[model samples]
Every structure is written in C-alpha cells, then in structure tokens.
Target: MDVLNPEQFRALGYRAIDMIAQQLADLADGPTRRPVPLDVRHSLEDQPIPETGADPFDLLDRVQNEVLAYPMGNPSPRFFAWVNSTPTPIGILGDLFAAAMSPSAAGGDQAATYVERAALTWVKDMLGFPQEAQGLFVSGGSKANLTCLAVMRHVMSEGKVRADGMASIDAPMIVYTSAHGHSCIEKAISALGIGSKNLRIIPVDSQHRMDVEKLREAIAADRAAGLHPVCVAASAGTTNTGAIDQLDVIADLCEAENMWFHIDGAYGGFGILAEQTEGMYKGMNRADSIAVDPHKWLYIPVECGCAIVRHAEAMRATFSLVPAYLQEDRAEPWFSEYGLQQTRGFRALKVWLSIQHYGLDGYRKMITQDINTAYELRRKLFARSDYEVVTAGPLSVTCFRYVPAGVPEEQLDDLQRQIVAWTNASARAFITTTMIDGKTVVRACHVNFRTTSADLDVLLDTLTEAGQLVLQGAQQA
Candidate 1:
C-alpha cells in the first residue's frame, strides 16, 4: 500500500516547504544561538528507536522541532569559521528536485547525464579551462583530489599500475607539494600506494607560497636518489592562509621535469573571479588536472566538487572498468568511467542551477565583495596595537591575533584558542583558530554572499568581548 495518498503527500510537502522557508527567514537572528536546553539535548541523545510505526505528520513534527531548530551556523552571514558557504535559495530547490528525480549519474544517454556534462562545461568555461577537458562532479574536494591523483599515478606508471599494481613500478614514485598544501594530497598519495614517505613536503616562504627554488632542489635531490618524480600538486589557495603558490613558476618546473601538474584549487580557485587576484592563477589552465569545490564559492548546497583533467582518455583509462552485465553501447562515455564512484548522485543539478541563478559576472562581484570584507577585517586588526595580523588576504581569509600589551608570551596561543571558545559559546558569532608558523591565531574566511562589513564588525565585537573575559579568567587562575 502507498505510504500516503498523492493529495496527502502534496499537503505534507507544502508543510515541509513552509517550515524550511520559516527557518530561512529566522536564520540571521541568533545564527549561532544554542536553542536546545541541556536537558532536552540529553533527552535527544537518549532517544530510542520506535518499535511501531508512527504517524508521518508526527515524524515531520519531530524533524522540524528537534532537528531543523538547531543549525551549524554556516548559513549565518557572521559565520566566519571555515570555508563553508551559505547555500543559495535556487540551489536548495534544485537539491529537492534532484532527489525527487533520483537518477543514478553513472552514464548512458539520460537526462541527468546530459545535465552533468553541461554543468561541467559551464565549470570549465567559468574557470577559463579548456572545454575539451573531461570532468566529473564528486562528493567534495577530498574525492576530487583522490580521483585526479589516481590518474596521475596511473599515467606516471605508464598504465602498468592499473593492471600489474604498484609492484610493476621499480623506482619509488615521488610526489612533491608544499608543506602548506591541503592534507588531502598526502592522503591521496597514501591511498594510491605511492607511500606518504615518497611525498616530499617542500617548505614555503614568508608569504606561505611554495618556494620555487626549494621545490627545484627537492626534485633534483629525488632524481639523484634514483626516485621517479611523478607529479607536483600545488595549491591555488591554501586553507590556512589563502596563500596561492607561485603557479606559473611551478608550472615551468613541472614542464621541465616532465611531471604531471595538479592544482588543488578546492578552496580558493574561484578567487580568480575577484579582480584583485588578476595574475594569481596564471598558468593554472596549463595544469594536467585541477580539483575545485563549487559548493564553497558558487553557493551550492554541500557535497559538490569537480575534478577536471587535461587528458580525458588518460583519466578514463584509470577508472573505466565496464563489467559484462553493465556494458552498454553508447556513443558518449559514462561518468562511472571518469572516477571512483560507479553510482554517483546527481550533484550537478544544484551546481548547474546555482551557476545559472548567478551569472559569471554576478559571481565575480559577490566574490570580490567577500575578499574586500576580509581585507576590511585585516585593516581593523592592524589599526589596533594589541591585534597582530598574522596572515591577511590576498583572498577571502584573514588570520590574526589579539595581543594586549602585558599578555604572557607563552600563554598567547592558549589565549587565542580560549577567545574562540568563549565567543562561539556566546552564540554571537562563530569563528575558529588555526596555527601559523607555530603560533595559534584566530582565522576567518569570507565565502558567504550574505556576509557584509556589518557581519565583520559583529565578528570583531564578539572576539573583543571574548578576549576580555578570557584574560580576566586567566589572571584569576
């Protein structure tokens, strides 16, 4: 029997939509407020599975009251914690429609397959990448990095790694990346059986960009040691400081070395849209592969990333394994042939809808606004003698610390962390801390289109209040 009649389903759906709309309207107020009481939270934790069927409406009520009422504060304009972006309204609706359609994006001449192709084309066009490049919408940056690096492994092995496994390679394949590179690169190396030890962590200069001279030295040293240099994974924008590596220089090195060049642009690739980053991403289009996250910059809902490879056939050969039962005679290659996942979700719908909702020019303006606001925070921090600017934008991330005159040198790092905790607990705004050059500092990333200078002010105010309380408590202790 049907769980609910069509008319009943329509009514329930409307109710659910209304609930979501209301939540969105109220999202800005107390964006980080802890709504649930401690007792109620304990009760929720102690919940037991129901032994019997419950009314659908009752379940919906629980979802609205218990779950939706509490949020992670990512939607708030003042949420300057990580790289998370507030989801666009159009993207949100696209997610709902995609789920309803429920098409496995594995390939075949289907609607979702075409939508995904078009979406990937849009991504390439938007990023100034070649339209001929092959791409796949993945879960997030982690999978995107893994997929591209896998192709690098296979290609560097001359396709023998796929058939004969890692044992086929005689020399140890070495991968080089900056110490500030995302941890996912090392994880991908380890996962591909390349061994993390073979991954060289090149040091960065004062600006946090990968030092080109040091990289060249490392490659030469590896060659002298009889290790095979496979690839160099450079960061378009590092997560901790938004520092972009010297891409054009790195590209030149990779070309001279005859190595695969991969750019991890997952967090700040889209920063290219900002006018201030005019020449920052130079030679990025020449990379053998690039990983990017539309969810971070395009305001798409979570779980959307793209891996674009210059050589489509090479990527296909790395993951294309058509079983006898799954074989299909289609002119267009299936998405399953592109990466690790066979049964992929229709992640492109939300991304496609979001890109269309805001054209490239629109995205550029919004992204520029975010970068400007981040710089504003940096300027404010610089104006105060007590606050020291650790790492400030060339993009939309700023890391700084409050160092009041008499604060103990040893306790500075601990004080910075305590300020974050106090401010977050107050629910006025949400921020985080990160280590830079062995010192803990407050970090903020501006990716939300809804965020403005006002939100930045709120963040500073909250931090100031939190800092005072932390210092007072420290003195008492």
Candidate 2:
C-alpha cells in the first residue's frame, strides 16, 4: 500500500479548502434546494465499481462538480424550514482535521479521548449542569434521547434490568411527556421494550407548555392503577412551536414523586446562552439527564449530540460491559462505559473548536439574534390582516398561516399547503408548515446565525405572493 507524499497531500488539502471557500462565497447565487435532474441521478446510479484506483485530484474534482452543486440548503441563511444551523467556517475546518486524524474515540489512553472528555465538560458548563455530572457525545438527537432513556430505565429498575432485561420487571413502567413532544421519545420507549401505550401524552397549556396539574393527576391515576411511573420527559424547546415547558414546576413534581426527570433540549438547550431566554430554562439543572444537539443550535457540523446525566456513576453502571479482550488497566474512565457506542468517531473536535472559536459571549449574541428574529417575524405576521398567528414567541420559532378574510375554514389547510409549495418552487426562501391546535400553519425556525431581518421580510413577502396566486388559481377553477 502507498500513501500520498506530504507535499502532494498538502496541495490536495489546499485545493479542497479553496473549493469550499469559493462555494461558500457563492451560496446566494443558487436556490436553497435544487433537486438533481433525473439524467444526473441515473448517471450517478449507473456508475460501475472501479477495479483500478483513480487519480485523487480527479475524483475530488468530480465530487465538487457533481455532488456539491446540489444541497439541501441547511447552511443557507434563507433556510428556516427546520431547526438546522449554518455550519461555522471554523467548525468546518475542525471537521477536516478530525477526519484526517480518524481517532476512534470509544476510549483509551489517547489524546482523542481526553479531547472528547474536555468537550463534554464544556457542554456541561455551558448548559449549567453540575460539575459532578457526566456526559458523552453521540450521533444526534435521536441517539442522545435513546442513551438518556436507557439510563433512566436502568436506574429506575434498581439495576436489575441490566442483566435480567425487561422481563425481570413484573409491572409495566410508565413515561410521561407532552403531546407536542418529539416522536423520538415514543420510539425510544418502544425500542427499550416499554410499550408505547405506557407513554402518557400529557396536555399543554395555551402557550403550549406542559400542564403541570394534568401531569400530577396522570401520575396519581397511574399510581392508583398499580402502574409504576418511572420518568417525566420535559421539552426545553419543542420542535413545532418552540414551546419551553414549565421546567421549575415539573422539576418540583418529579422530586416529590421520585420519578426521573429528563429534559429533551435537542434544539433549544443552547437557548440558555441567551440572557433573554435564560429564565425559560430555570430548573433545567435539576434534570436527571438532558439530551441536546450541538449540530442544531451550536452551529457545529452534523452528527453531534450530548447526553449529560446528573449521576455519573449511574451512567457508567448502565452502559459499562468490559469484555475480556477489551480490558484495559488504566485509571482514567473510558467513555465507552458511559454511552451506547463502542466505536465512536471524533465528534467532539468540531464542538470543542467551534466553542473555542466563538466564546460564550459570542454564542450569547448569536442566540439572542435568532430569538429576536423570531419575535420580529411574529410581529410582522400579526401586522398583516391575511396572516393569523398560531403561536406567539420569544423563542426561535413562529407558527402562523396565510388566511385572508372570508376564506372558508375548510379550504385553509389546502391553501397553506399550496403556499408552501409555491415558496419552494419560487426559491425565494424555504419555510415549513405544521398543524397547530388542529389548524395548519406555516412554521419558521431561526437557528442560522447568518439569517437576518431582511430574510424574514422576504419570507413574508413571498408568502403573501404565494397566497394570492393560490387563491387566484382556486377562483379560476
């Protein structure tokens, strides 16, 4: 086997960097999303596996021309459809360095392991978690949620389930979360052998925050019915409306009931950095565990999430399973003993580098900007007679619909769908739609630091034009 000489490697690396920088500079020249043409797709699919190695520079050029030409537009400032952030340029460079190193961060006496541990520590501090808390980076929100729930199950079962499995428990355990909570929670429950039927869907108040009184009543009813209530999953920032549940009240209830309190802060956990939104997460420190995504709000590259647990020993107990061949005589704790993956990638490098590049103060400014943008968009929507605000916000999400007066209620949903299609087709901006309180409404989330007030104006203007066109088409029919 042969490797490129240092001189050749440096040349290729510099070219790749230049190519990416040029693309970033020209991002505004293209649409947020461009579907690959059928011919291009077919050509890509029909390519046969090569028996001989090709020139590395040629392969890189082909990838740049064919693959990078089309993207989902998550990095674009105009992309407000979902809770995706525009990756910071520094973070992108950190990703390249991590890939070059290719360290298996599962655990060992290696520099990568220490780097990951330090990154996780910074995350704990950033989120106001106790210094004694332990955490590990995982793939993303879904896996982060799963890792937290697994520990909750292990501790709640008194460590019996670790060896005997779910069959060891005689009674079914119950989990509680709001109706607007992410579906990933239910999926975690099902995967953990806890029936989805056992997961109680609690109601939310007018602002979409979880109703604490209802939650208490549900817990009482479950206790009366002889079902073991194990945990309560609270949402720091819900996906639909960016609703932050009443964390303080819920934390009190969890303490009184002796139930595990888990906070799903995948998209909103970093909101704590913004002074204006800090109060919303007042009791988050009391949570037994929190699942947060660095990729979403931290402006890091994708496939990075953190799962922090209050009790470090409990996490180790739940996940540690040292095989004979894998045994090491090191005093330092291995990260593999704290999470699900045994062969983890160097995800922490990007996080560590990004945080260092933009200190806490810088992050606070960016997050505050996003929150202010959300409020600004809501104010604009309220000013319009054709738009109806489904949810009001200080958070980084606003849900509304384009409803001209006298439009039949039955036609509103279809009109909203048409407006979204028109926006996507026009390529002026990207926004999504969701059902809020049984009414279809357009949802815009401001997580990209690059997004601006002008983008929001464009979004509103485009939505207005789309709505008018949709109504005209309906009348012509």
Candidate 3:
C-alpha cells in the first residue's frame, strides 16, 4: 500500500526538483566556492553511525536545513582549491537520469555494452590512444594510476610480479618518475609489493617539470648498477603547480630505452580538448598506458577515473583471472578480464551524456576560460606589491606568496602562512597552501568550469583584505 502511493512520491519528487533548481540558480551568490566553517570543529560529533534509519521526509528536511542552506557549492564561480568539479546543468540532469536508469556495466546486454563501449572509445580517441586499446572506468586517478601500474608490472614481469612477488625477480626492476609525480605511484609500489624503495625519484628542472636529462642519467646508472629499468611514469600535470613534464623528450627516452611509458595525465592530459594545450600533449599518443581523471577536469561527478592502454592485450594480461565460472574460451568484451573491475559502475553514461549535451566546443570553451582566468589571476597578483608569485604562471594553477617588499624568507614564510590561514578562515573564497622550493606559499588552481575572471578578482581582493588583517594582528601582538 505504501509503495502504491504514487501521489505522495510525486509530491516528494516535486519538492526535490524545486530545491535543486533553486540551489543551482542561486549557487553563485551564496559562497565563492569555498565553504570553511570556523565553528564546525567545535560542534562536530565523534559518534558512530545511528542504529536505524530515520523518517525519509524528516531526513530530507534535515538535509535541506543543514546541507542545502550551507554552502558546499562546488559549482560556485569562485572555488579555486584543489582540482574540483564543475558539472553543467546538462550533466546534473544526466546524473538524475543515470540514477533513474541504473544500467549495470558488466557487459552482458547488447545495449549497455554498445553505449559504454562507445563512451570508452570516445575517451580513448580524445587522448589519441590506439584504436585497439581497451580500458575500464574506475573511481578516480589513484585507482586509475593503480590500474595502470598494475598492468605495467604484470606485462613487464610476464605475470611473475603478481604471482611470486618482487623477490622472484632476477634483477631489481626500477620504476622511474619525476619527484613531482603523484604519491599514488608510491602507494602502488607499497601495495603491489614492488617495494617503494625500488621506485626511483628523478629530479626536475627549475620549472618543476620532469628533467629528461636527469632521467636518462638515472636509468643509465641504475642499469649499470645491475637493475632493470622497467617503466617511466611521467606526470602530464602536477597537482601542486600544474607543471607538465617534457613529454616529447620523455617519449623519446622511453623509445630509446625500450621501457613502458605511462603518463599520469590525471590533471593536464585531457587538456587536449583545449586548442592551446593540444600541441603541448603531442607525445601522449605514444604512451603505452595513460591515466586520466574525469572527476578533476571533465566535471563528471566523483568516482570517474579512466585508464587506457595502447594494446588491449596488455590490460587483458594484467587483470585477467581464469576461474571456472568466469572463464571465457573465446574472446568477447567480457570486461572482467581487463583491469581490476568485476562489477564496475555504468560511469560511461555520465561522461557520454555530458559530452552529448555540451558538445566538444562547449567543453573547450570552458577549459579555455578557466585557463585564461588563471593567467588573469597571475596578472592581478603580479600587479600587487604585497604578494609575489613563487613560480611563473600556470596553464591551470598558480603559486604565489604574500610578503611585504624586502622581507626575509623566514618572516615571509610565516607571514604567508598566516595570510593564507586568515584568507581561508574568512571563507569568502578558498585558495590553498603549497611549498615551492621549501617555502610555504599559496597555490590556486583554476579548474572549476564556472569560475570566471571576475570570481578570481574577488578572490584576489578578499585575500588582500585578509592579508591586511593579518598584518594588523601581527602589529597588535
């Protein structure tokens, strides 16, 4: 009888629709994309989960009052923290549609198979990977990177690495990555029993890009010292500074060295969607395997990271397991054989629907705007005297520090940290902190699709005001 109450469900549905619509319409004015409640810690509870579920309507009411009213607005035009998502209205609508129609992406039915494969194909094409390459969508970059390294290790070791562990190897297989590469690789080493000690940290250039010369020397030295150079993991865009490595040079090195080349293009690889950055990623097509996170740039909801390997055979070799029930005598796109997915989500729908609704041109425009806004922010900071850029402008992220003219580095670091603290505390907008060459500094990334140059300016002004307040506090003390 309760399930038969369509009228009641309709009323709830209408309420939900209205609330979401209102939230989306007025998202920009509420918070500038950064929600920092100074009093949150004081009020937060350290309790376990409740024993039972509360009334659905009552829970909805609490959500509306607490969450809806508070500004966790990721879509706000001023969120410039860590890499963020800015899903379009169409994408949001598509999310609703996906929820309504939950297609299991385990490759059984013809319809789900066709659509998800089509979306995966589109992703591979965007990255300029081989047509024969196959992939599976995972939750995010960490998982994607894990899948990639797992596949690489599997192929390089010819199944020995997974079966018998690194101890079974004749020589130490060295994994090379720039110092700036994400820690996920390190985590992969620890988890995969490859030994994080075997993961070689190559140095970077002044621009923070992976130094190809240093890499070559390190590989040569390792080989001379009786180690096998198994693979090179290059960062397409670093998380801290959006620093892209010299992919062309690194690609050449990989070819010469005959090692597996994996590009962790989690941040910048997909910028091929942008006209300016398109050529910068020219060498990505040569990668044996690559990782990209849709959650960061594609503005898809969280848990959407993709991995593409040039040869479908490699992925098949990496994650394929042969059990009686799951064994396939002949080849089909039985997805369980590729990567570490048994029952993966129908993530393709969100990506496919987002691209279909926005089109390539719209996505490009948003990416271009975000890049330009980052440059614009750099210009604004350069114009001011109180702040100084620690590095050159970013294609997507900018790092700067607040220091009065001629201040010593020690005092500058403390003041800059204080400035950042005050600015985030104010909660008008949110930037972040990073260390550049051992000095603490503020790091801003312009990945949010909704953020405009105007939002960047407002953030700049708010930071400046906050800096002045910090100076006043210092004086009072």
Over the stretch 246-309, how does candidate 3's per-residue lDDT look in tens digits? 8878888988988999999888877778765776787888889899987777788776898888
lDDT by residue (tens digit), candidate 1, 298-336:
888998989999999999999998899887756878999
Residue 207, candidate 3: Cα error in Å is: 2.0
Q: What's the lDDT for all of these models?
A: 0.89, 0.89, 0.78
Candidates in descending lDDT order: 2, 1, 3
Off by over 4 Å in 2: 1-3
**For model 3, the run of ten residues with the poorest summed lDDT:** 38-47
Count: clashes, candidate 2: 0
Worst 10 residues of 1 by lDDT: 26-35
By TM-score, how accurate is candidate 3?
0.93
Q: List the residue pairs that clash in candidate 2.
A: none
Q: For candidate 2, what is the lDDT?
A: 0.89
Q: Backbone clashes in each candidate structure, one number apiece?
A: 0, 0, 0
Error in Å for residue 439 of model 1:
0.4
Error of 2 at 2 (Å): 5.3
Error of 2 at 19 (Å): 1.6
